[model samples]
Target: MAANGKSRNLESFVKQQLEGAQKRFGDLEQEAGKVFRTLKARSKGQAREVEKLLGQINSDALLENPKVKEFGRKATQVSTDLRKRLDGLQTKAVEAVGVASQAQVKELNRELSRLSKKLDQLLPASVKKVTSRGSRVSAS
Candidate 1:
């Protein structure tokens, strides 16, 4: 009879623990759902704002405003200036590193090819035959 009472107490304890865990998980799920809905609502509102702004940008009234036109001009000028500065910095960095720029490399390749062709033309027929027999021949 004592063993039977102890068994009943253990079962009751396990059942209470399971019920507590289920309640906690349910509360967490409800909180997560509420957060997701709030974010979705805010995202929809922002999307509407973006659409309205796009419509305004395309409107003739906004485009014709002097302030807007001035802003556009300033923006273009800033972009151009930034590009020029970047190009200058890139050129300086390339020169400092002693590495050939693209243009210089291209010119060098063209010159090398021309010289190779000239050397091949100048070499005697006998030299080409010797080159094929395992000995390398190169024009100075």
Candidate 2:
């Protein structure tokens, strides 16, 4: 009789836990739905804005000028050539100094960050990568 009572209590406890979990999951589902709806609305608004911007862009008659286009093409080529020369100079500087340049350091840091995120996924959740710099944001 005692054993039966214990088994009955255990079964009731399990049922209660299951019900609680189901309720929590239902709440989570509702929250997720709300978030999805919010994001969907925001995305739709952005899409409309982008569409209007593109329409305005298409309506611009100045872009159709051949002379304007030729000038743009030449400007682009000059900029590209100048960029190549500058990059060559930068590389020569880095070689002469026998050290990584700021640009190189930033690129390496970015690659390290990407790899660290991937590595973190494979490792335990308790582990996190640390950053030396404080939070600093740059304008585009």
Candidate 3:
């Protein structure tokens, strides 16, 4: 009897914990999506600005001027560096989300293991009670 009660309680606890984990995972996934979208939009805007600068250089009458060429080169390098940084940040964000997901899974497993142990400890007494009660009822 005690074993049955303990098993039921453990089952309930496991279910509750899993539900909470699912909620947390969902939230993290949504947040990651948001971060990706934000980064993409920012990258697109920067790319557009770089394109416009290049187009301006092409239109300028001083396109052959040394200073103008140097400025254009510097602008290109800056844009390239910005792109690399953004790419790094995006990669890091993805890795962080993955780590978070793994951690949540580990936590859920630990909780489940603890609950199972507790149920195991309670089971013998529960069975004994149920068997005794059944015998008494039959005798009566």
Candidate 4:
């Protein structure tokens, strides 16, 4: 009976632990989402700024000089390459966030499963203890 009571207590404890873990996972997921959104906005703004700079340079007197023209072309190409790299990085960041989110979820599930199994091992003895005592007590 004492063992049975112990099992119930352990079960209740495990349930609380699982709930806490789930809440933590939710908070982490929300934070990750916010970070992803911020990165996306910043990338877009940066791309726009680069485009504006390139446009201004192209319209300037430097474009009329042969030597300057070559330099300007090279600069534009570099800018384009940088923009492409940024885009690739942004895509990778998104993918990383997704993978991290999945990993977190999996971690939470594994924790819950482990706690549940531990509770299962302890519950029978707790129930037996409670029954033998012949009195009801709050699990909390």
State which candidate, 2 or 3, has the greater lDDT: 3
Global CA lDDT computed for model 4: 0.72
- What RMSD, rounded to one decimal, does every model reach? 29.7, 24.1, 9.3, 10.5
Model 3, 55-103: lDDT tens digits are 8775556787899899989999999999999899766764654433567
Best by TM-score: 3
Which window of 10 residues has the lowest lDDT sum in candidate 1? 1-10
**For model 2, the run of ten residues with the poorest summed lDDT:** 122-131
Best of the two (1, 4) by lDDT: 1
Tens digits of lDDT, candidate 1, 43-121: 9999999898887776788789999899999999999999999799757754654556679769967976786577567
On TM-score, who's better, 2 or 3?
A: 3
How far out, in Å, is residue 41 in model 2?
A: 0.6
The CA lDDT of each predicted structure is 0.73, 0.69, 0.73, 0.72
lDDT of 4 by residue, 1-140 (tens): 46557758877976786676577657766887998899999999999998888787855675688997898789999999999997997567555434334676699679868876775676654442344566744453
In model 4, how large is the Cα lDDT of residue 89? 75
Q: Stretches of candidate 2 above 4 Å error? A: 54-140
Stretches off by above 4 angstroms in model 1 are: 1-59, 102-130, 137-140
